[model samples]
Target: MVDVTELQRQHIEKITKEKKLITIKECSTLTGIGERKLRELVHVSGFPCIRFGKKCMIVSSLIDEWLINHIGETF
Candidate 1:
């Protein structure tokens, strides 16, 4: 049987190393935004995205820019 803990650890390591792109869940966590809100912002405001096969990933750099630009401003 596969070791679930090892699998999770590997997944975490992969994500940490590939910081350029992230899932909606990761983006929401990093930006402190709800998943629904993040999706709306990405769709309406043209938030940066990186398409990988069938998945849509957000660029971490763009999230950093958004955070810097919106710092101290109420969401």
Candidate 2:
């Protein structure tokens, strides 16, 4: 069971890294940020997200860029 959970985590990491767009839940998993936090961030100005109806998708590369750009900033 532990091994299976590890494999599932690895698979999620791979998908998060490889996919151009990822769901909020995937972003939360990848970033270790809560889904609720991600949902709030998605609504913030300049957050990198695409909305399809009520669902939101995050741009993976943009997240990287956002992280880089935020380096040294106090949260």
Candidate 3:
């Protein structure tokens, strides 16, 4: 399994705030990762997300950590 470096985890942890929930569009804006791609990732098992009625919400820190873990991926 891919692991997040300490530095990357620290950066991601720092972004975790009291208002931890975020919309998919906000996630895309903050990460520079498109909404469609985020949507795809959300469906993967273990990908952090909570279904709120018809909306899918995610924890900002979880997504950040996930992105860090995937940094070395190709395509």
Candidate 4:
């Protein structure tokens, strides 16, 4: 059987290494935040983001920074 957690880690690593921007859904899944909450955070928190046409893209690096800043040593 496949280890789901490891698979998720691998996917995140791959995306980060590739410098791939992710959508709100993907970000929510990776960060365990709900879509509505993510949107509100982005709207209120001035989170780093890019909007291309109708789509919004969040950089993996920005997310990493936010995590490092917000999450304590427990992470």
Clashes of each: 0, 0, 0, 0
Which TM-score value belongs to model 4? 0.74
TM-score of each: 0.57, 0.74, 0.67, 0.74
Per-residue alpha-carbon lDDT of candidate 2 for residues 1-75, written as tens digits (9 for 90 to 100): 268878878988788678999998888877888998888888777889999999889998789788678779644
- Where model 4 places Cα greater than 4 Å from the true spot, the runs are 70-75
lDDT of each: 0.72, 0.83, 0.75, 0.76
Q: Which has the better lDDT: candidate 2, or candidate 3?
A: 2
Off by over 4 Å in 1: 1-17, 52-54, 70-75
Candidate 4: residue 51 Cα off by (Å): 1.6
User: Model 4, 1-75: lDDT tens per residue?
Assistant: 999999999987777778678888888877888898777666545577778886778876788688667765321
C-alpha RMSD of each candidate structure in angstroms: 5.5, 2.5, 8.8, 3.9
Which segments of model 3 are wrong by more than 4 Å? 1-18
Off by over 4 Å in 2: 1-9, 72-75
lDDT of 1 by residue, 35-70 (tens): 988766665454688666767788876777766776
Residue-wise lDDT of candidate 3 within 1-75, one digit each (tens)? 656576656654465564488888877766778899888878877777888887998887687687777788743
Model 4, backbone clash pairs (residues 3+ apart or across chains), number: 0
Extract clashing residue pairs from model 1: none
